[model samples]
Target: MENNLKMKDMILTYIIIGIIALLGNWAGYHVSPIKALPGMLIIVLITIVGWGIKKILPINLPAVIYISLIALLITTKIFPGSEWIIKETGNVNFLALATPILAYAGLSFGKDLHEFKKLGWRIVVISFVVYTGTFVISTIMAELSFRFTGKF
Candidate 1:
């Protein structure tokens, strides 16, 4: 019963996010909402499927893992109808979707300020270390890729 309620809430939330992304796509990218709706709906359907898969599977894993897997598989050349899916989804500007998603992430962080405060300075130090490591690794990878491809 609880799971069903959570599913409903999640679906509603996805729909709301899709609507907001559509608005953002129209306003920021000059794409008509009507034109983008199909792609938005396809994306939302994929997300719902991913969420459902997470719920059905017994293993403990993040929904994002499932969502990303689903998206990746459907868009790959090996997948049937991949071209159509890719073409339809291309109408939606990714940045438009990212803006609202990032805004919500920021809001979530703000809501967790108390929990964040309890971590004290350790979180800050860890954050810096993690960020620096990520930056260094990313730079190295980018340089290697460029050298290998003879693009630098």
Candidate 2:
């Protein structure tokens, strides 16, 4: 079936990404690939399960929502074996995972430039305003939090 093929492709893609992330982790952060393998496997499993959930659920929702929820649930104190999950996943450097993802995002942005150009000037102006507003708001919130926590 087409769905099976899609799942197979997804699994293969996740494994490749995981391997690249592990290598990045080793090269950039000095974490051995052997040490990070468990964490990477767990992450891949979580992603696959999230995608599976998205397919099974009738409601239209992004796979990220399911992925985040699953991650949050498993890592929370109430979940059984939460500590072990946290400990293993902590081996993976966040930046290691982010590098490939950010690279992909950059490529996607480049690919979508034609579509992006089709949008009018007004949309561009609105996007800039929204981006600036979000950045300002986030900065203010971070400053306030740091002040409250006496971190700065």
Best of the candidates, TM-score: 1
lDDT of 1 by residue, 1-152 (tens): 42454888888998999999999999999999999988899999999998889889998788889899999999999999999899889989999999998998987887878877788787889999999999999999999999999997
lDDT of 2 by residue, 36-129 (tens): 9998999999999999998898988888899999999999999999999999999999999999999999888878899998999999999999
The regions of model 1 sitting more than 4 angstroms off are 1-5, 115-126, 145-152
Q: What TM-scores do the predictions have?
A: 0.81, 0.80
lDDT of 1 at 95: 100
The alpha-carbon deviation from the true structure for residue 4 of candidate 2, after best TM-score superposition, in angstroms, is 12
Worst 10 residues of 2 by lDDT: 1-10
Clashes of 2: 0
Q: Number of the top candidate by lDDT?
A: 2
